[model samples]
Every structure is written in structure tokens, then in C-alpha cells.
Target: MQRGFFVSGVASTMAENRLDNITHNLANVNSTGYKASRSSFKTVLADSHLAGNQKQTSSASYLSMGSQYIDTSAGSIRQTGNALDFAIVADGYFQVQQANGNIALTRAGNFSRDGEGNLITQSGFPVLDDGGSPITLPDGEVSGTNDGMIYVNNQPVVQLGLVTLINKNDIQQAAGTLITTPESNTESAVGTVVVEHGALESSNVNAVLAMTEMVATLRAYESTMKVVEQYNQLASQLNSDVGKIQG
Candidate 1:
């Protein structure tokens, strides 16, 4: 394959990956406490030959991994009138107990109580209290405060676990979600996260921008495909012409 064709092929692939991420963010725009994700791109370095004496120069550009971006920007808080719904007031995450016994951090505040009276996200993951215990809300009208206290049956039953990231950049995003080794990084996890009841966070993704980028990426991909087809046709014609001359 021609070097130009190879470069265009890689660029198209990278653009498609970025488009996928943007599409996902737009799809989850209405999700409660959802955060928008961006894509990070890095240029691949050209191969280096043995240096003569002083220095070397780059030849061609390549595509590196397309990193999933985490938008730490705070979303707009909206009141939902449901006491179980909550929103973070600052830089922190509400820890939830995943099915695999691993803790996961999320901004999604739309929560509910199970038949066992356990406070959990809509996905059924149990929300954690300040002590890392499952919060159990009683059956009644509930009220919570930004200080991390939830009142049920006129008594404080659970305190939401609000924690902040010490090294926000150290967190890695994989499979369209953020994951970290919570035990390995102690110093990076410091201040407690804050929670406000009766409210939920909105996604920061701009739908208009996402849609525009998606359309542009699609067109670019099509153009690259056309180039590849032209190359193939030219190569085929050259072979046919050579055979005719020899015959």
C-alpha cells in the first residue's frame, strides 16, 4: 500500500474512535448525574534510524491510542423534587458497591431503596455511607442535606460517602468508565465529597457539537474509502495494459 493511503487509513480509524466516544456522550445526555467524556489523541512517532552524529528528524505521522477523556467540569444541578435524588456540590464522587464487590465512583445521583431498605443507584448498586456501609433508608418521605446526612423516619440513618481525588490525572478511563486502584493511591484520595439531596447533575456534553463532529467524521471516512478504491482501480488498469502490450 502507498504510504499516503496507509496514513489516511490510520487517521480515519482514529477519527472513528473519537466519533464513537462523542456519540456515547450525546446518547447519555439525559442520564442523571452523568458526565460528558472527550477523546484524547496523540501522534505516533516515526521510526528512528541510527544517528550519524548530531540529531535526527521525524518522517511521517502515525496514530497512537485514542484516550477517553474525563470531563471534570461540574454539571448543572437541577432539582428533581425526589428526595432520594442527590447531586455533588464539589469535586467528589459517590462510591457504590458494584456486583463484583469492587467499589465504583459515579456522579449519577438518581437513587432508590431496595426491598431490603438498602439505598442504591438505579442500576442496583448499593450506595455507600461515610463509613463505607450500605445506606438503608426507611419507607417514608426522605430529606437529605449537603453536609452528607440523610434523614429518614425523622432520624439520621446514613451519611453519604463524599470523597475527592488527590491526583485526578492519575485516574484511568477504560471501557467508557473511570477505574482506579483505590488501595494503591492513598494520599491522592483526600477530602470528603459533598452531597445535596433532591437534585441531580446534568451531563456536560454539548449535543450540537457532538452531532456536528459525527457528521464530519462520517464524510471524512467516506472520502478515505474513495481514495482506497481509486488506488485499487489504478493498479488493476496498469496490470491489464501491461498484459495487452506484451500480447
Candidate 2:
């Protein structure tokens, strides 16, 4: 697998993976609370250990995709003027209960009240309160304070469920805009989060940058494929010449 063709094969696959990620970022450029993914690279040796292998074979080195992480940077907050919409100005996530009774974190706060007066997300998941219970609001001019306290007509209702992650890497994005982390990675962030009423957080993906990277990745992939193709042709020609000489 240390041959030039084999290395080019791996390179092509890696480029395709990068292109996929870039495509996803571009697609979600307008999505609410969307975080873009970033890819990393690492060098390895075909002798099996670049980190600890004492072998001095520089020609056998290989490149690989190291890791992928969700960029947790905050996006622009836009005022929607809708009372149900909310935005977290700082480091925190909103908690919502899933259909299977599991909890997930999200930054998308484009919420609305159900017919039963329960505050739910756009996906219909009931939003949790500071006490880890569903937030049931009474009708008539709903509002929230900067500290996530909800009040209706100047009467207190409940506080939004705000939590923070201990390790940024612990957050894993799920289907749609929802994300989850292990229970050990999360803690109640009651006063740590600053919420804005009548606003929503846009995606952090930069469209122009992503598009440029997409083109670059595509070109790199094509170049690797050409190398692989050229290698195959030369290999075939060499085999044919060797057989003719033997005959």
C-alpha cells in the first residue's frame, strides 16, 4: 500500500471526504443554529508507526484524514420580532426532550407554543425548564428575561433550560440542528447563559469560504484520480513489455 498509486488512492478518498464536508457546510449556510464541520490531517508511515516507529523510511510516509469536529463558534443573531424566537448570546445550549424520553441540546431557539400551551421547538419537542420539566406557559404576552426567566403579563412562569458543556469536543451533532453530549459533559447553566427574546441565531458557516474550499478540494481530488489513472496505465504497459521480452 506504500506504492505511489496506493498513496494517490488514499489521497483521492480523503479529498472526497473533504468535499463532502464542504458540501454539507454550504448546504447549511442558511440553517439556524448550524455549526460547520472542520477536517484535520495527520501523517503516518507505511512501516506502521510514525509516532513511535524508529524506522527511517521517509519515502514510505502516508497522509490521512485526522479528525472532524463541529465548529462551535457563535453565529449572527437576527431579530425576528417573534416572541417565541430566542437566542443565546453566549456559551450555553437549550435542552429539549425527545420522543424516546432522551434529552438533547440545541442552540436553535425558534420555538412556539403548542395548543396545550406547552413550549416546544420547531420539531415539536417539548422545551425543558430549569427544573428539567416541560415549560407550560399561560396565554397572553409571553416574555423572557436575559437570565432565561419567562413571564406572562408580568407574572413569572418558568425559566428556560440552559446548560453548558464541560468539554467542547463532547458535543456531537445529530439529525437536523439538535446536538447531544454525555450526561457527564453537561451541567446546569442557570445564570451562565444570556438569552435574547424575539431573536434567532443563524448558522456559523461562511458561504464564500466554503465554496472556495469546495472548488479546491474538487480539483485536488481530480488530480489524485489522474495520478492513479496514470499509474495504472504504466503498470499495464510494463507488464506487457516484460511478457514480450520473456517470449
Candidate 3:
């Protein structure tokens, strides 16, 4: 295969993936407690040998996506005036029980109650307390302190589960508002994990920046495509002129 074809293909692929990533972030700009992701990469050989050719050019190496990491920085907190909604003021995640009896971490605080008065997230997952158990609120007015302690009728009911990742990079953005939390990667809250009741955290995505980057990526992809077209044209000409000529 032509070296330009290989290079162009890899380049265009990188741009396409980058565009998809930016689009996802922009789509969730209004999502509560949503954290944006940024791409990182490293150079790697696309193919060591191709079409029985043993020698390859230095240009065969291309930039490959090494990994993606969330921004992790806290988003702006918006006051919802709803008692059940809460926002984390800093680095920590709220624990919610999934249908599989496993826990998923999230920063979204738009919580409500299930039929049994169990505190639940918007997706209907029961919220966990500090002791790693589902919290069931009694019938009464509920309130919370900055330290994550919940109260009903002036009596403490339970403390919310607020935890921090031992290494922030260990987690990944999962389906809709949930984060892939590894149990071993998490630890009890360290430092002051402030909680703001009656509010929710806004997504950290910057719409303007994302749109600008999308435009740039699209241009890059187009340029790479043009290069690939040129290579194809050259191949056709070679087949017509060189491959057909006989001495």
C-alpha cells in the first residue's frame, strides 16, 4: 500500500474520533454534574509490514489514542430550590446502587424518592449512605448539613455516601451521568467534602470551545482525505502507464 494512504487513513480516523468525542460533550452541556473528557495520545506504528513489503518508512508511525481522562474539576453549582437535590462543592462522588447490586459513582444530585421512600437518583438508583447502605427517608421534612449529614424533623437520619478516587484517572465516563467506579480505586472522603443542599452541579463542558475544536478537526479530516485521493490517483496512473508498458 502507498505510504500516503496509510498515513492519511490514520490521520482521518483520529480526527473522526475526536469529532465524536467533542459532539458527545456538547450534547451533554446542560447535564447536571457532567464532567467533560479530553483526549491524549502517543505515537505508534500503524503496520510493521504490509503487502509482503518488509521495509517501511518512518512516516508509518501515527498518533494513536492512548486514553481519555475526565476533567475532574468541579462544575458550577446551580440552586434548584429542591430539598432532595444536593451538590458536591469539591472532589468527590455520590454513591448510587445499580440494578446489579453494584455501586456507580456520580456527581449529579438531582435525587428523589422511590415508592418505598428510599432516596434515589433521577435514574431510579437508590442513594447510599456513609455506611454503604441504601438510605430510606421517613415521612417528614428533610434537611442536610454541609458535611453530608441528613436530618428529618431536626433528627439525623443518615450521612450521604461521599467518596473520592484514590487516583482520578482510574475512573472512566460511563453511560449517562454515571462513572465507572472501581471499588478498589475508591477511598473514604479525605479533606473537607462540602455538600450544598437545595442545589445541583452543572456540566463542566464549554460549548464555545467544543464547537471551535469541532470545526478545526473537520478541516483536518478534509485535508487528510485530499491527500488520500491524490495517492489513489497516482496509483491509477501508475497502473495505466508503467504496469502496462512492455519492452
Candidate 4:
């Protein structure tokens, strides 16, 4: 196979991955507290044995690994006029008790009360209180202060728990939520987690930007395919000419 064909093919594949990321972002533009993900690419040198020229003037196209990580950039806070809808006032996440008792970080604050009167995320994960316990409000609606204080029926009950990740990079995007395991120096709940009532955070994805990127990536992929086709045609023509002369 011609080296150019292989290089062009790789380029086309990278563009395809980029397009997928853009498309997914556009689809989730309206999702509340959604974070836009950006795809990253890395280049790996071709094996020495596959080197066409010792001078290394020729290079294989850069290989792209699927999105390195989702950008957890903060989204804008929008007023929802609902008391249960809360937004973090600062750089923190609402501590939710996940299924297996693991802690998960999420920006989704569309909270509601369950049968047990526990404040929970839309997915039913119980919201953590200051003492690393679930915040439950039985009598009436629960409200919180900017300093992580929670009150039920106008009576102070438990404070909200705000968790911090020791190594933010260790966290991975799982089903659009940030999942992390316990790490060193990582405290379960700190006193600094603030909750804002009656507001919801908007997705950080820029619809216009994501749409533009999607189109650009598709065009780039088409161009790469064109290059591969042209290279293959030239090779075929050269082989046919040589055969005619030899005959």
C-alpha cells in the first residue's frame, strides 16, 4: 500500500472522531449544567521498520485517541424560580451519595425530595449534609444558605457537604457525571460548599461554536478522503503504464 494512502486514511479517521465530539455537544446544548467536551489528538511516530525514507522527511498522519477528557468548565447560573433548584456559588460540587456509597460530583442541581424526605438529585442520589450524612427534610421544604447551611421548615437541620477531589485529573467522565475514587488528602466533606436556592446552572456548551466545529470537521474528513482517492488513482495509472511498456 502507498504510504500516502495510509497517512490520509489516518487523518480522515481523526477528523471523524472530532466530528463525533462536536455532534454530541450540539445535541446536549440544551441540557442543564452540561459541560462541553473537546477532543484532543496525539501524534505517534511511525515504526522505524516502516520508515520509507531514512531522512524521515515523510511522516505518517498524526493518530488521535478518543477525547482525552471532558472539559468540566463551569456553566452559567440561571434563575429557575424553584426553591429546590440550587447552584454552587463557587468552585465546588454538590456531594451526592452514589449507588455503592461512592461520592460523585455533579453540576445538576434539579433537586427534589424522595419518599424519605431526603433532598436528592434528579437521578435520586441523596444530597449529602455537612456531617457527611444525607440531608433529609420531612416536615417541609428544605433551603440552604450561601455558607452550606440547610434548613427544614425554617428550622436548622443539617449543613450541606461539599466534597473536594485531591487529584482532579484522576476523575473520569462516567455517563456525563464526574466519577472519582477516594485519594490522599481528599477530604469527604469540607465546610466551604455553598448552595444557592431557586437557581439552576446552564450548560457550558456554546451551540454556535459546536455547530461550526462539526461542519469544519466533516469538511476536513472529506478532504482527507479526496487525498487518498487521488493518491490511489495515481498509483494505479503508474502501474498500468509500466505494464503496457513491458508488454
The sequence of per-residue lDDT tens digits that candidate 4 reaches over residues 54-78 is 5544444457564556666778888
The TM-score obtained by model 1 is: 0.83
Candidates in descending TM-score order: 2, 3, 1, 4
Worst 10 residues of 1 by lDDT: 183-192
**lDDT on C-alpha atoms for all candidate structures:** 0.74, 0.88, 0.87, 0.73
Q: Per-residue alpha-carbon lDDT of model 3 for 1-247, expressed as tens digits?
A: 5666777887888888888889999999999999998888889875555357567544456787677788899889989888899999978999989899989999999999887899998888989998899999998998989988889998999999989998888887876789986799998772369999999999999999999999999999999889888889988998888866952
Model 1 misplaced regions, further than 4 Å:
47-58, 62-65, 172-181, 185-193, 238-247
For all predicted structures, in order, the TM-scores are 0.83, 0.92, 0.90, 0.82
Q: Lowest summed lDDT over 10 consecutive residues: which window, candidate 3?
A: 50-59
Q: Rank the candidates by lDDT, best first.
A: 2, 3, 1, 4
Candidate 4 segments whose C-alpha is farther than 4 A from its true place:
46-63, 181-185, 235-247
Model 2 clashing residue pairs (backbone): none
Per-residue CA lDDT of model 1 for 1-247, tens digit only, reads: 4666677677777777877877888888777666677778788766545477646654667775557757777888988889789888877777778788777777788888889889988888888887777887778878876777889767887778767776666665433333444644423222355677788888777778879988898888788778878877887898899999999
Candidate 2 local accuracy as lDDT? 0.88
